[model samples]
Target: MTPRGVLGADELNNIAVFKAVSPSVVNITALGLERDFFSLNVQQVPQGTGTGFVWDTQGHVVTNFHVIQGASGARVTLADQSSYKAELVGAFPDRDIAVLKIPAPVAKFKPVTVGTSRDLQVGQKVYAIGNPFGLDQTLTTGIVSALNREIESVTHRTIKGAIQTDAAINPGNSGGPLLDSAGRLIGVNTAIYSPSGASAGIGFAIPVDEVNRIVPRLIRDGRMVRPSLGVTGGGPEINRALGLPKGVALVRVQRNGPAAKAGLKAFSRGDGGILAGDVITAVDGEPVETQDDMLTALERLQPGDSCTLSVWRSGATRKLTVTLAESDD
Candidate 1:
C-alpha cells in the first residue's frame, strides 16, 4: 500500500527541475533612445524585457532575434535581481537567435546545460522558465504539441524545424528556455502563433539543433551562409493552350547559376524565342508539385550537393546532373 501523504515520482521531479534550471534563466531589459522634436531633446524609452539563457561561462547569453533588436543599451537581471550591463556579441535574425555578452565576472556566471531537440516527441511534458513581463524566473508547464514547423521569422525568412507547444508562452517569454521533464533546455522559446496579440495557448520555439548549427557559425563568421540554386521561374500555367501540358517559363538565369552551368536549354523560338523557359518535372529524385516545394527542397541544401533535374523539352524527357555551387551574394 502507498503512504498516505507521500509524493509520487512526478511531483518530486517538477520541483527538482525548477531548482536545477531557474538560476540560469535570465531577464534581458533593453533601453532605447527616442528623439522627440516636441521637447527638442532625446529621452530613454524602456524598450521591453525578454528572456534569455546563459550560453557559456564566458558570459555569452542567447535569446531571440527580436529580443535585443534595435537595442542601443541593455542589461541582464538574474534571479536575485542582480544586474549586469551586456554587449551584443552576434545575432542571427533568420534563425531568431542572438548572442549577448555580459560583463559579469566568471564567478557571477552559471552556464545553462544545453539539450538536443532531435529526441523530443509529441505529447511529452515540458516546462518554460522565463522573466515574462519583467517577472523574474517564473515557471509555466505544458507539452510538446507538434514539431518541425516552418514559421515566418522576424526577418521575413522562413525558419524551418521549429518546436510547437501549447505552453501558454507570452510576450516576455522570447529567448527563454523550453525545458524537458528533466530540466534540460530543449528549445528556445521564440514566437507565439496567436491572432489576438496574446497567448492563445500556442507557442513556438527554435529547435536546439538549429541553434547548434548556427550559434558556432555566428560566433565565427558573424553570419549564416546558405546555398542557393540561383534560378527564378514560375507563373500560372505559363498560359498554355487547352490540352498541352503546363510548364514554367523562365525569363532569365543567373550568369553562372546552377541551371546555366548545367547547360540546360531555354526556349527561344516563336512563342519561345530566347524566352528561356524550362518545364521542370523533378529535382534530385523529388517530384516538384509547386514552386514552394522546389524552394523548400532547395532551402536546406549546402554547397556541393549534387542535384539531378528532369525537364520536359521538345516533347522529350531528359535528366541533367549538376553539382551545386556556393553563392556569396
Candidate 2:
C-alpha cells in the first residue's frame, strides 16, 4: 500500500478544529415517561436525542429548548463517553435555547470559544459537530450559505438573524455548535429545511450573538426577561378586518400599566359601534408593523428603559414616552 504524504492546509485545519472543539461537544438524551399496558406501571424511556456543548466551567450545558421539551428528565454524555444526570437550569423558548446543569467537576469541561455572528459573510467556511442519528462526535464541514435568516422556534416565535449553513445538520444535531474556521462557536444548530426530515443541504443555526445575549439571562433568571408596554394588541386578522394601518392595534391595555399610564387607549364598544384606539406604529423611532416586530424592537431593552412610542390615535399620529416594565409572559 502506498503511504499518504503531507496533508493539505485545509485538511490540517479541519483536523485541528475537530480536535480543539470536539471535547466541548456533548450528547443529550431526553427521558420520557411511559406506562406498561399489562401491569400499568410507569417507567422512564428515551424520548429523543440531540447534541449540546459545555457552556462554562460551572457545568452548564447549552442546547435547544425543543431538545428537552416535554421530557421527564435528561442525561448528558461528555466527549470521553462519561454520562451524567442533567438538571434543567433555565430556558428561553423564544430563541429555542436552553441551559442544563450537571454535577460534574470543572475539570471535565472544556467550554467552546464563543464568537460573534454580526460580521459573518456568506460563503465563509463553517463546521458542525453533533450526534446525528444518535451517532456521537461526528463532524461535518460546509460554508455559510446565507446570513440573517429567520427561523421559527418551538414556541412559534420568529428567531431572526439566524445563520444559514450547508453543514449537514440532521435530526440529532439540534443544540450543537456551529463553529467558524478558527473553531469558535458562531451559532447553535437548530433546524433544517428538508421535506423528508433529513439534511437537504440547508440548515439553520441560532446566531451566537443571540445566544450570548440570552444565555446569561437564562442562567440568572431562568428565562428571557423581556420588557413589556403592558398592552395586549390584536392579531393581523383583526388589523386587516378593521382596515387598520400596518401596526399593532391595541385590544386591551392593562390598567395603570406603562401603556395605560402613558395614556394609550384600547378598543371599546360604544352605542354607535366599535371605537378605534391607539395603534403603536413604532418603538424608539423603529417602525414596527406587527406584534412580533414590536417584540424584536424591544428585545434589547430592559425593564426600566424609557422608550418613545409612535402612536396613531383618532386618525392622528402622536408620540408618547412610556417606561417599560417586566413582562410576565
Candidate 3:
C-alpha cells in the first residue's frame, strides 16, 4: 500500500495558491427582465452567471461587462457561501471590465493579491479561479501560452496587451482573476477562442496593467479617462477597401478639435473626385496600422498631452504635432 504523507512540491504549491486566492473569488448571478410570449408580461428572470473577484475591502467587485450587461441587477456569492446584492458601479465595455459594489461587511471582502503582467514569461505556470459552467470555486492550471496579444472587447474595440493562457477558461469564467503561481492576480480571464463556447485550450485575459489603470478611475469617476485626438476615421475594413496602406484615413477632422487644431488635413472634394486626406501612420514613433492601433496608442496619454503624428499626405510624408483632448462622448 502506498503511504500518504506530505504532498509533492508542485502539488503543495497548487493547493496553497487555491487556498489563498479562493476566498477572493466569487460567483455572480445576474438577473434581467424578460417577457413571456403567451402572457406578454415582463418578469424578472435569471439572465446569466459569471465569476468575479473582490477588488478591495470596501465591497467593490470586478467582473466582465457582459456578465451583468442587459441584466437589471446581480448577486455575488462568496466562498463562505455568504451572498449579497451587487450594484453596478461602472462599466467600460471597451475593456470588457465592470465594477460592482456590494453591501457586504469588510470582513467578507478579502481582496486578491495583485501582480503585474508586464514581466510575465511564456511557459510560466499560472492559475485561473472561477466558476466555470456554473461550477463554483473551480480551479484550472496552465502555463502562459503567449503575451501581448490583442483581443476585441464587447464594444468592438481592441484590448491590447492581453495575456493568452490555456487555463480552461469557460463561459462562466469571465472576469475571474488569472493568477500566477504565487496566487497574485496578473490578469482577468475574459474570452476564449472556441467555436463551442468552451475553453478549447485558448483563453485570453486583460492584462492587469490596464486593469490597474482603468479600475480605479471607474471606481472614482464611473468612467475611464480615454483621451482622444478628435479625428474621424473608419475601421480596418475601410482602410483596406480604399486601397490605402495600413493606416487610418482621415475622412473628416473635427473643427476646433485636437486634430484640426494641430493642422491635420481632412478629405476634400475635388474636380475629378474626392481627394484623399492625411493618413496617420504612427503616433509618437509607435506605428499604428489601423484605427484600433491609433486608439490604443492614444490611450497611453492623457488629455492636453502633446503627441507627434507621422502623416502621409499628397504623396508626401511629414510629422505633425497634436495636443490631445477629452472625448466628447
Rate residue 35 of model 1 by lDDT. 93
| Local accuracy of candidate 3 as per-residue lDDT tens digits, 1-329 | 99899889999999999999999999999998889999999987888899999999999999999899889989888888888888888988999999999999888889999899999999999999996444458999999999999999878998989999998999899999999999999999999999999889999999999998889888997887778988887667766766776788887898899898888877667998767788899999999988888988887787889999999876788998898888877
Candidate that beats the other on TM-score, 1 or 2, i.e. the better one: 2
Sequence-dependent TM-score of model 3: 0.91
List, residue by residue over 127-158, the lDDT tens digit for candidate 2: 99996444459999999999988999888889
RMSD to truth, every model: 4.2, 1.9, 2.5
**Order by lDDT, highest first:** 2, 3, 1
As a whole number from 0 to 100, the lDDT of residue 183 in candidate 1 is 83
After superposition, the stretches of candidate 1 with alpha carbons farther than 4 Å from their true spots are 1-4, 36-43, 133-135, 233-251, 264-329
Query: Which structure among the candidates has the greatest TM-score?
Result: 2
- List TM-score per model, in order: 0.79, 0.93, 0.91
For candidate 2, give the lDDT of residue 124.
97
Q: How accurate is candidate 3 locally (lDDT)?
A: 0.89
Which portions of model 2 show Cα errors greater than 4 Å?
A: 36-41, 133-135
Deviation (Å) of 225 in candidate 3: 3.3
